[model samples]
Target: MRPYLFLFLLGIVLFFATCRKKDTTPTPSTPVVPGCTSLLAPANGGFVTTTSVTLSWNAVSTASSYDVYLGTTPSPTTLVGNAVSGTTHTVSIPATPNVTYYWYVVPRNTTGPASGCASGARSFTYIVISMPVSLGYHVVGYFPSYRSLADVPDIKFRMTNVVVYAFYQVNSAGSLLAPGSATAPLAAVATKARSNNAKILLGINDGSGDGKTNFKNMAASPQGRTNFIRDIMNVVRTNQLDGVDMDWEFPTTSDGTDVTFTSLMQELADSLHRDGRYYLSCAITAGKYAGGIRDAIRNELFPIVDFFNIMAYDDFSTTTPYRHHSDYALASLCLNYWINTRGMPAAKAVLGIPAYGRPSGITQSNTVLSYRNILSQGGNAQLDSAIVSAGTFTNYTIYYNGQYTVKRKAKLSKDIAAGVMFWEKWQDATDGQSLLKAACDTVGRSY
Candidate 1:
């Protein structure tokens, strides 16, 4: 009995000792971040022709509100707007024309004190143009099949007083057109524009590549170019188009090719300007050289062309970790690069954005995934990627690592460019709160 008592006592003593030891293992903690998903609007710097330019953004989920700042410098950032709620807010700029102003937004919540959300600082140039005026057109090709254009108020909103609104493009390359056709859609677009009391800028841009593209040779060869122009002219005559927008995917970098391309543009600009019946426009690259070509056009063809829209999106991959296309800063940099660095006029510089987004995790092996399919089960992990359209590729591969998927929201705000352009109107969100519409709203312009 004594031995059993001794053993029981020893066991009790050991348990007490174990319980008395202090635990040293660390507990998991939440990430110490000022805010999450605080964004800059206009994704690309947008056009402004007013004493005031609006700045807006999607609100941070954990943020109770936001603080807006503006200054010529990044540090000692001057406060402009404060305590803005909802997902978006607008800030006004009363600066003079062509002045670059920097801005940022901060998030505040109960979990954290009011802290700087300090987004990637963005900037834009301002000009004094007419009030509530912007220059652009919505060219929808994937419509009715993708979404209805009538449901898009952004298209009809600013378009009310504006001259041009929408153009239903008949793709000469893809399913948009049969072997040789443009008249049907051309007539349809014209009728709709007339009904809306607006002008339809005909889209003659062919996106088809080397093979299986009828317009490929047309853009590259002299005879083909001539014939293509004739076809476009015929459509203009038949539909009474207000103007023609030649969207040749790209031009030749070959020797003497530059001269030919310049000559072609000059002739088109000259002929169209002389007609006195219509306007001429071209969609050019968003790079530095675009400014050079635009200068040439202005010198030789500005008399005929109404404007040259710089297609600014599609710079980076949406699937990659780096933010692509509509990067707020990248857009600003491009605008500064072109206008300040390369020397292009702000009035003629219409910036382009994409209403569409590229799938990041979608690969060759497994391709189909909607916005729903890509979200994480817990919603804690977001497949972060930049939102922008690719320059000339159907799709790219994203490596499967922890179920990371990214999609682009190519909207614009901030201080940026003159106007905005989306690749196609049909790709706009169902609610009309799409990339292009967002840009329009930010700039206080409609549609």
Candidate 2:
């Protein structure tokens, strides 16, 4: 064998070895097109109470990202989110009620997007709340004497049709207790409320102890009822109030107080309605749970009262996934119980929405944080539950209705009830994050 031939063969072997090494390095392969995602939330043809909605879909295996499209038409030409990495996309714009909205999610990989995604688009109807035009919707707020009047925004007074000056206590004998230090504040608030074109009412309730015992005793006898009505009217006249709101915590059927309660309410309504210029309202229980507490508000008193403020908050359920004290579900149930089960008129049903939230793992009465304080302590406005440090506990998960839920509830009120009512006006935030403002905005009421 010649040296030149052997050298040439060795060089060829080296060249072949280099080529093999190069072949060992992996070559890039084209990515497979992702499968179409399945829409999960806001079920097709379903109704959504909230303006802000979260659009969610089942993740596709090969999907690197997703494109979300939403619009009024079936095809949904508007591109809401592009290249969204997650399976969910929260709608940033507020949805209009009574409008049908269509959405499409297109799963995509490096190769291309899934085909026929728009053809399989889903749709949902934003509920249209038909509010009465004749009577006009009422936004009622309870102004408690304990809270500083300055904390309440001036816009709140104007937003509310009725501002209740809470709790001028009543004795067992049906005589009114002195306002004492609250008199000046009451007068000031009443004056402000009246100036804002809001009807201010004097709220009467049983004093400190014995729950509804004082109210029960007062309403039991004719003389006591007469005395109570007289004092209420006198107080209304003195305060220049438009009417009276009876806050009898509860008058149970088991004790026969419910019977007397009807009589008392009838008498009060007669006296207040005589001039045809005053309103008579009552703060009733949520009626979510079964018991004497629910049956307290008898059906007979429906016609006697102008409106019943259904206290729908402070609900506690151990079996629920999240222990939300004032959840939207509870509000719906309360309204159904009042208007459907009990046969109360929809126009007279005023749903109550709390301005405060209760912490998880804590009793409803044990811990309550106002919406403003919750936001100040790192509460998320978008999410319903927030992890925050409250009192001795660190990283406590507090469950409350955020701005979204408040707006949802307000919309719910317009759908089936006269209006929405807050437990206390001062509990709301002063800024744009104000729960009152959210509610008013949803109901199309300017604040």
Best by lDDT, which number?
2
lDDT (10s digit) by residue, model 2, range 1-447: 699999999999999987784446777889899888889988999867678889999999899999999998999889899999998998854555568889989999889999999998999877533222224688988888777877776787888888999778888567988555663378888988988888888888888576688888788899999898998888887877888888888888889998898899887876676536578889999998788877878888887788888999877553454688888999999999899998999999999988777775555453568778889988877668887776666676778878899889899989988999998788777888888888888888875
Question: Which stretches of model 2 miss by more than 4 angstroms?
Answer: 1-135, 317-321, 364-366
Indicate which candidate wins on TM-score. 2
| lDDT of each residue in 53-146, candidate 1, tens digit only | 5677765666777777777664437877666676565656665655667777777665564454455677665644321223343322221223
Candidate 1 regions with alpha-carbon error over 4 angstroms: 1-184, 211-226, 288-304, 318-320, 360-416
* lDDT score for residue 233 of model 1: 66
Clashes of 1: 13
Q: lDDT for each of the candidates?
A: 0.49, 0.82
lDDT of 1: 0.49
Clashing residue pairs for model 2 = none
Model 1 residue 208 CA deviation (Å) reads 4.8
